[model samples]
Target: MKNSVFFVLVNILLCACGASANAPSEAEVFSSAHTTPNVLMIVIDDLGWSDVGYNQTTDLLETPNIDALAQQSLSFDNAYAGAANCAPSRAVLMSGQYGPRHGVYTVSPSARGNAKARKLIPIKNQRGLKTQVITMGEALKSAGYATGTFGKWHLGADPDKQGFDKNVAGSHQGMTFHYFSPYNLPNIKDGPKGEYLTDRLTTEVINWIKTPKDSPFFAYLPYYTVHTPLQAPEQVIEKYRKKGIKGEDAKYAAMVELMDTNVGRILTMLQAEGLSDDTLVIFTSDNGGYRTTSFPTPIRAGKGSYYEGGLRVPLLISWPGKIKPGLDHTPVINADFYPTLLTLGKAEQPNQALDGVDLTDLLLNQQAINSRDLFWHFPVYLQAHHARTDQGQDPLFRTRPGSAIRSGDWKLIQYFENNEFELYNLANDLAENNNLASQKPNKVAELKAKLKAWQQQTGADIPTELNPEYDADINQKMIDKILAKKTHH
Candidate 1:
């Protein structure tokens, strides 16, 4: 009887051990056992879709580090920026709302170009992001993450006021006056004489990541390289010049390479600190490239224009073992990142409604997200960079007050100036060279109805009142001058 009792006791103990093994621990339940990943988002300023070597569109530019990252990441071919330009695009990403929701449609004043060229009174623009809106940093920080932003924060004057625990060199300023040290930026102090801005920003992020912490971190490194005032290291520029790429093109190429090199450094540090597998790395551009400097070919116009070139950008998401590396052609925008990161970090949704969809399934299992129409509303005017080569509707302006929607493969752009519609079948013509509005009335009607409904839903303002300063003759003369110059060239 004693021997039988001993065997029974052993059986009970074994069962208890098995039960403990099957049940999840407290750390596992909360995902605090390093299961909750770190987020490192690197945003490049004015980098084009075809600038990277993985795209194989440009032979002049070299980006080995970015190309390597692309090989191990889920590259998005149809990813787009929230807006065509800098300030508005950054606002959309931060707020996870459309331009209409935040009332930040363009940079500075809504009136751009000559007053006589603007037909309608454009909507008033908001210079900075309102503090009331919840930012990604705040959302992640609320979920027990250490949030830090190490670069441009064009949304507001202070990033710390908005969800970030640490802000390096971010401010309301759109672009840096100089890429070298003595940047004159409010937050950052002067470094050595020739210290580059991109390099300094990357170093700051690396140092921030190195700090000991109990919780995971969200490192937002928005490098201000590859933008205007085209300056690069002389040696790197010389290297490009030797390859027959001289002048501004050589300087641009050098800037791109330097940015890629910094990205490599970050990747190396993550591995060194044993944070590679525990981190989710995202690399993308704020908008499309500057037209004259890095024109995205076969995609049409760049920067301010709402063409494929201006909206489309390179996107790569890498999570060592968690996310499988491959190419995803699904159409996505920067605003989508807001909900996606929140979901991945297990953060609660804010009180305000989010316009973007959560991409967790798409990021993890390679499953496709629900089909939805993408919209862009610009109730403001943006003048052309180079009227002759901007490839916009007209030479005078890159974009008039307009609203655009992309439903499936069809894209419709409605201009408030003329109440006119320009439609294109993107699947067949990615360049947006052919307008099928005249040929397919049913398709145009369908898209227009959808766009109209979206406009009403989003409360997108449509400028209708005519501008008192608009002069038809003056606009015509400017157009004529641009045309004459193009013809002469």
Candidate 2:
């Protein structure tokens, strides 16, 4: 959570990332006995549903290994990230509660848009995870598990302080300077010249798993790949460019392919080490793709937007002998992972209050959770990427200060700025192309009442203080500038 503008070292140390490292092998090793299930939660950064073959197949992108893994996994049809952006989503996943509990609505201060364009003064955001709250690593470490976090941590400096035994590259910084050496990242040392950050991190994981340990390990591989400052191998970039992909699309696709390659490496290592069957591999992303790089269709706008495109993400859970393999449409969010993993690992539940329910039943037995309503609270303003092209309610921002909930087939969103509600029956309109709030007043009332009650119960903050500098004329002028740009294009 960077409260101020982040700075990075301009010069890279120039080191080999991991080209000479031992190539992956198909050799399978064995052990005497398996006591408990190991957890391998792979949280990829800023990936969308349509980016992978499992969610939406296209020759435009190739993710054969992930697709194969999906075939052997219980893939979710309606999976969601905790928040519409990065840090808050990770916070929700780690804490197992909504924004109200953790107060990490977005990275840094929540008031993102220009002051004149904003109507309300956003709720102040916490820059780091508090020590009072129990983290996932801390909970699992207490349960006698060897916990290691190998990539971007974002929350704070030194995950070791938060109960991790081994942290290869994790700290207070959110994104690396560039995806290369001399990253200017805190707590991570630079490798050899021309080393790719993704490959280096993958090698680190491989080495970690190779070490024979007594307790079942919790490998939290939160890759910084598929994120910004997009950098990849020249050959990989050339491969996608040959397919008619160019500019940001090609660079982004190359990085995605590289990420999938590294993921395949990890999966292969588990199988080779005879750890596949006993390990539960949970795969998902923090949120959707950034609007600038790549965005898949049928869902609405990209990452910052609150529509399905930003919230809905790809989720896959695979445990060879324990869980079944197939598709499941049980609606789920990132918070569910904390309680679900605690229960599955036979760990003690924390004393503090948790908003998510234990989902071990759903994970192992394929049971559906259709009754509980999943919610998201973002009492902040997120400016739109491209007001003309980006799918957002108003032109100023992708999402204004708002709270949203999805219960069964209906999903309702309440924007605090205008006290306006937008309702959609997802069963019929998955894209949320139609707003049924005006049409079905009764349905709107029912869901709105529930949302309001839940907010009060959770002590959710609603931004009400007017931004004294707010000017309607200035906001309209900004909107007009975008409109004018679009017309010219």
Q: Please, what is the whole-model Cα lDDT of each candidate in the order they appear? A: 0.88, 0.82
- Residue-level lDDT tens digits of model 2 in 277-366: 778899999998876765667787778777888899999988764566788888888888888888777789997777877766666655
Clashing pairs in 2: 14-193, 15-192, 15-193, 16-192, 16-193, 17-195
Please give the clash total of every predicted structure, in order: 0, 6
In Å, residue 93's CA in model 1 sits off its true spot by: 0.8
lDDT of 1 by residue, 70-123 (tens): 999999999999999999988888889988898988888899999999999999
Q: Estimate each model's TM-score.
A: 0.92, 0.91
How accurate locally is residue 22 in candidate 2, as Cα lDDT from 0 to 100?
A: 40
Q: What are the runs in model 2 whose C-alpha is more than 4 Å off?
A: 1-35
RMSD after CA superposition, every candidate: 7.0, 11.6
